[model samples]
Target chain A: MRNKWTKVLMSAMSASLLLTGASSAAMAKAKAAPQPVVLKVLYMSQQGYSTAVLNKMGAEFHKEHPNVTIEFTYLPYPQLHSAILTSAAAPVAQYDVVLSDLIWTGEFAAKGYTVALNNYIRQYIKNPKGIPQSVWNGLSVGGKVMAMPFLANFQNFYYNKKMLAEAGFKSGPKTMAQWLHQMQVLKAKHIVQYPYEDSWLQAEGLVCDYVRTAGEFGNGNLFNAKGQPIMNQGAALKALEWMRMLYKDGLANPNSLAADEPTAANAFASGQAAFNTNWTFVTGIMNNKSESKIVGQGVVSGFPVAPGTNRATLSASISGFQGLAIAANTPASLKPWAWKWIQFATSPAVQAQHLHSEWPIWSSVATSPQEKHLNPWYKVYQQNLNAVYNRPAVSNYLTVSSIIQQYVHEAIGGTIPVKTAANDMVQQIESLPK
Target chain B: MTSMPVESPPKRATLRHRLFRTLSGEYFWLYLLLLPSLLILVAVILIPMLFAFQMSLGNTSIVVLGGRGTISNQWVGLQNYLSLLQNPSFWQALRETLYFWVVSIFIEVTVGIGMAVLMNQSFFGRRIFRVIVFIPWAIPTVVNAMLWGMIFDGDNFGALNDLLLQWHVIQSPIVWLNPSALFPQIPWLSNALSYLGSNLAMNSIIVGDEWKTLPIVAILVLAGLQTIPHEYYEAARVEGASAWRQFRQITLPLIAPVLTVVLILRTMQLMRAFTLIFTLEQFGLPVLSIQAYQQAFSFGSFGMGSAVSFLIGLIALVIAYFYIKRLYREEL
Candidate 1:
């Protein structure tokens, strides 16, 4: 009887061991499979693809990756910086992916608020050669790519064709001197009072216009290669004097002292002014039948340069390109999925569809016939891109911008001499924390 | 008085019972009732204020961009304040703030009283008129600001310009807030008032603020007016006092307390007038409130921002103390 009991017990132990091993194997298999993930994305609402189109793209991304979901939030361009900073500072970041302006890349990367994307770009991107080297440099910090280039844009010159014709001009002005002369003629001919409209409000718009104008005068670079400000010298100083002259002579709209980008664009759109320079978003607004009175009259061109300055290769139009960065604090488990979405969304294939509204970041997509056919101003936009100027990429660019805005605006308003304002602006910028 | 019931001094009570009785006393309950509000006040107001004060004493700025959102600080006591004192911009901002405060309050108070007196009289559509007066106040500050912004806009499409052109009162549009155009050219005065900012810009802001704030002040004064007894006025008339005389002697003195309260409240509000000015012209007018915001957010110099904010609080406190003391003496 003892022998029979021992054999039965051994059999029971063997069967239990088998069952436990099978269960453990099944659990391991389940763990290896993809788990459900939800990613939150933030984008600027003022420009770029509409939220509806983005939502559709997100849905498509979800279909391809069955277990992942994408959630998106949109804020205006001005609010995006603050929101990005606030979210990155939170205990657990509020966003997994964020759209950042070109100006913010340095600051965001330097702070470790955004993750470096060099490794991911190498492993994931197929045929990355299509992207321009400058585009890559714009999205990098300390020689590491910190973001993926999303939208390519610059301040393109917009004008009313009829107004130019009325002033006896056949084409847009190629130099600042010519433009000023044309504006004077238009003003004297009673064609348009204050022939040029400007968004010289005390904000980033002022800085962009200044940079573009400085570029026209010569070098638009605010800082030298050694990262020291040269704004009190050379082209930068000349730009301010020219701007002040415009305001003093009443060649530029006096209302520009308080106008923002939209207000300036509206002035051109309504045919109240002959010429304006603004973002590519104005392309749609200028020619829209419902939004513009100059639907067929508005024409696009490369930004004008100073007469003595070289206008051959680059016109120095300030580039307002934007890109995507993953939050540094995003969970490791979720980052791969986040990258997947970014990779898919900013892919040349998906970006090509929005060419009419936004400039494509990929050169291959940019030169495609579809893009040129969709955008009538494709030739001018392309020409402007050849000579685009990126704003100073310092970590404290916004602070630098604020100082410039204040002094430049004061100078234009005639509160102080242009030389004094320039000198003071440079001094304040130099005093910022390194 | 009826004899109070004096009960037992009989048995020795246990310690727990004595404690319970003590806690159940009226004073304990009164304190217990105040506990929640006191806790809320400490957490919401006192604690943050203390933090702000502490921050003002050091170079404590939120260096989010470079430090991953950590607050970077170095103890540099009184430096922020001293620097602010020396800064011309700060002084200019302070001057603008006072200008905004004094000018707006005077307009609101004077217009408010006139409105209250007019509304106090028996008139047709009195109810409708009251509602109409309240409409500006009821509309949000931002909406009111935008409305006035469009009205005062320099463009030909602006309401004021369109109206002026239609009436042939002006042949061309006026840049209502252009600082250069608005700067007074008195040789002696120009240099002194160089940093006083655009009078026209400041005036436009004051006008917008007055239009929105007048209704509330009128309504408040109207409430005080209603509380007066009719017999006093009747008695004044019987005594053969003139209408203006009655108003000067009776109405003015009687409504002094209400007016004092309004003045104190409006003074505080005007010192911190941010939304109206910001919506109309952001950083266009470098008033104290806008300066504080710019220092903190734009420049990320939270230390300087705190110093400015702390100074503003001190100024407000000094003014309030004067008002309170005057009120106390008046009561005496």
Candidate 2:
């Protein structure tokens, strides 16, 4: 009787072990299967670029992962940053994927609003090498990638080809003096009312123009290694003085002081200005027949260097790249899907298709022969991207940029002399808490 | 008297019973009627003011949809205010604010009064003229600013520049919005006008704001003008009073109340002028409102911004106090 009881107990133990193992296997399979997810993407509302292209990419992403649905919220550039911050501060995550300005990387990372993308890149991204190291660096903070750089833009020199040719120039100016001479010729010949127009309004646009112009004269960096203001240096002063001269000499459009990017672009596209300096997107705008009176008449060239300086030393233009990142508040379950969307949006195929309007951050997409064939301006854009100047990556970049904007605007407005403005800027920046 | 006091000594009302009685009495409905508005005032105005005051006392640096969005209260009591006191930008903004307030209020009152007097006359198109005068006030302030921005645009395509060029008003197109261009160096009055001229950006903004607000002021003044009996004017006319004398003696005194109210209200509006100037010139002309906004939003210095805002509020309060005292004296 004792032997029979022992055998029965052994049989019961074996049955219980089998039951537990089977249940564990079923649970693992359930967890591995893709669950339904809805992701919200925040992006700028740029015409034909952000809204259209992002929606297309979302649809494609939906096709790949049928369980996932994408909901996009398009905001104006001025409102996008504020909206993202508001959503991040909410108790629950509002956005899964965010399209962020390069200037915002440090601030966002410091606030813990963005998750580190390095692990995702290593695990999910098949061709991380397709993105340039410089771009990756721009999107990274403290050895961790904060976002995936997708759109690359920089300031480029744009001029009316007809006006230049009419002024007896086969190519655009290569030096500051040559550029000034061409402006004079354009003014003298009545090819345009003003030699050039710019988005010099006392805003972020002014900072962009200032940095690009200063890079041609200065060390191509606004701050020193210690994060102290170096804009009062000789080269930067010369750049400010040059801009003042443009205003004083009636070479720059009088309205340029009040004009934002749209106004400047409109003035150029309306054939009211012979030359304009703007981002890469303006090239597509100027070339489009529907929106441009100067269609097929505009040409893109590298930003002019100082009179005798080599291109290597003074060829820098301000980079205005926008990238995508997963929100820090995003649930762990939703992170994989968010990263998947980012990858799909920034993939080579989509980038090549929108190459004419939206600049590519990927080296492969940027240099793709098919893309080059589709958009003739790709070569010039790539050339401009080669020597891009990034703004300071400090967490307080917005504040720093505002200070630069104020002093530089006062200088341009003649409220104070350029020297005084530069001194004031340095003093104010020095007074900022370390 | 002793016997009556003995009977009257029946217990005085309890505190709770008296409070309940007051609440349930004739004033109860009146209090109920005011409860919603009182709640709104506390929620919208009082709460925010208290919160801002609290923020001002701390080293709060919250830049709402940008920056770090973290609130750090290091308890730097009065440091922000002291720092602002020593800062040149703060003084400059204050100076600009005073200049804007004085100039905009003066122009608005003058134009508003002139329009009011003219519209008071029984003319053939008086109704049509009144409608025309109020059109500017009907337009949104931002829309008005944008419209004026386009008109005063410094480009050759600007309507004003184009018209002036066509009329040969000057040799070349003048940069209407350029602060430096507005005031050329005059040998005699350079010292006085130079500073003012360098701030033409502020003046241009003032022009835009006045265009939007003048109509409202005129309408208010006109309503006050209508309240005055024509018999007073008739009596003065029979007594051989000149139009100027009649206006100085009767019209001015009678309309002083309306004008005082207008001054107080307009002063408050101009003291906190942000949207029009922000939309027009941005930080081109730094007034207190713009300075506060820049401190809070652009620089993320919430404590400093709150201090700046309180300073502006204090100034407005002091000015309003004087105006109200003057109004009360006039009423007496």
Candidate 3:
């Protein structure tokens, strides 16, 4: 009877141990469950990925992370900068993630508005695999990764092949002189009254166009290694004078002085102009039946070189790429999830899926045969990316850009001389608050 | 009990009676009734104006102020004002604002008076005409600006351009939104015209502003016109006074008070006019309000923006003071 009692006691003890172990394992899993988080994100409504694509991606992200939710707010491109600045001034961040323009990376980072992603990149990204060095250079400020490369864009040269053929040209012009000659013929023949449509308005569009032209006509960089303005002389001066000549000689549209990018795109898409330079997004607009009159006749090519200039390896388009960044004031608990959202959004697979809307930041996806097949402009975009005139990464870049815009616009408007405009631009930029 | 109550009531002043006596004093209840509004005015208007003045004396950004940091650290007394005085953009913007004010006020008063007189007549479909005149005023400023922007667009798709083309007014489209392009290319005339601040762009803005602003002035003037008895016109008609003479002597003098008030009010509104110009021309027109907007919002320089704001407020106040003084003097 005693032996039977011992066996029962031992069996009971073993059963209790097994029960405790099972319960502990279950409790640990419950503890490890992710906390629910709602991340507020801000993005530009125009250009880059559409809201629908981003929403679809958000839904997919929620599928993997059932505990996380993404809330989005869209503003126009100009308002996005102000909104981000205004919101970041708050103690608790209003947005957890923001889409930052490449031009704003320096300013945003310097203001401590965005969190550095170096640690997150090291932990999650491991290898940036296909992102180009130039892209990283744009997203980094003071050797700190302020954002993740999200979209790659540049000023793309778009032409009407049918118009050029009618003007007795087989292919697009390889140099500015050749393009000018072709425009003259097109104008003389009355095929198109204004052969070149440019965004030379008194805004950022003017600066972007001027940068590309200066790169093609002037020296390689507007600022030197010491980060000083050198646009007062050399290729920059010539580029400004050439732009004035285009407008004065009646080769460029008279409305070019008042036109922005969309206006230029409209003029090109409606078969009103034979040659135009605009963002890569214009390709979609030019080919879209609803938005274009000469849909299939539009051709995409790298920016042309100035006459007597040999830049075989590098092209002279402005780097108009953008990035995804985490706000600095995001709560510590929500930061990890913010990084996850950025990672998923910028992943090569996701970017490749939406390749038709925007160019992938990954060099591999950009050059992949599948992506190339999907976007024929990818080939030309790759060539344009070879050497782009990156607006110098300065904290005061907006002020600098504004000064350039005003002077260049004055020159184009015939309110000031080209040399005086160039000299005044340098003077004003140098005088900006440090 | 009656004798005791009469004796006791003679000696004491009760708190309720004393309070009632105080309340019955001159304008006490009037001020007491206005307490809520006064509090609101102090909160919304007085506090912000004072704070803006404080900021105007400093060199700070919205970030610093928004973060609740001590602005004294960034203080540079009167430097913002001094710098603004030296800034060429500020002078240009001031010139544009003056031009806009002079043109808009003149047009608003003249057109408003004309509309008021016409509407005062016993015409058929008068009610419908009044509503049609008010439709532009009822439309939101943003929507109106956008509508006008589309009409003034320098594209082939623009309404004005398309209409002009269809009507055979011109063989080629004119770039209406650009001042330099819209003006004739004659050297002497262009230079003279530039000095006068009479660009097509500003004139286009005035046209849009007048469409929306005329009704308010007209309604005010109409109310004033109604106050003048029909007997006055009948008396004048009984005399040898002509129609033009009667209008000049009777209508002009009678509506003068309302017109002065409307002009002063419109001056304040026009000096702060930003949405119309900003929406239409963007950075193209650097008027005072746009300058303030750019400094505060675009450049994030709150100090400079506040200085610009204070200057605008001071100008409006000075003009109001002069007009009000004249009004009181005329009354006396």
Please list the residue runs of candidate 1 whose C-alpha ends up more than 4 Å from where it truly belongs after superposition.
A1-33, A311-314, B1-23, B63-69, B181-194, B330-332
Q: Per-residue alpha-carbon lDDT of model 2 for B196-235, expressed as tens digits?
A: 4235677777888888899999999999999999999999
Residue lDDT tens for model 3, B119-149: 9999999999988888888989989998987
Q: Residue A291 in model 3: shift from native, Å?
A: 1.6
Against the native complex, each candidate's DockQ, computed on alpha carbons, is 0.30, 0.25, 0.28
User: What lDDT score belongs to each candidate, Candidate 1 first?
Assistant: 0.83, 0.81, 0.83
Per-residue lDDT of candidate 3, residues A13-130 (tens digit) = 9999999999999999999998788999998887659898888889989999999999999887767887887777667778889999888888877767787889888888866857
Q: Please identify model 2 stretches exceeding 4 Å from their true place.
A: A1-41, A48-74, A85-89, A93-97, A188-190, A307-314, A329-337, B1-14, B63-70, B187-198, B330-332
Candidate 2 lDDT for residue A263: 83
Candidates' TM-scores? 0.90, 0.88, 0.90
TM-score of chain A of 2: 0.90
> What is candidate 2's TM-score against the reference?
0.88
Worst 10 residues of 3 chain A by lDDT: A307-316
lDDT of 1 by residue, A232-312 (tens): 999999999999999888788888887888888988898888999888888899878998999889888887787667556
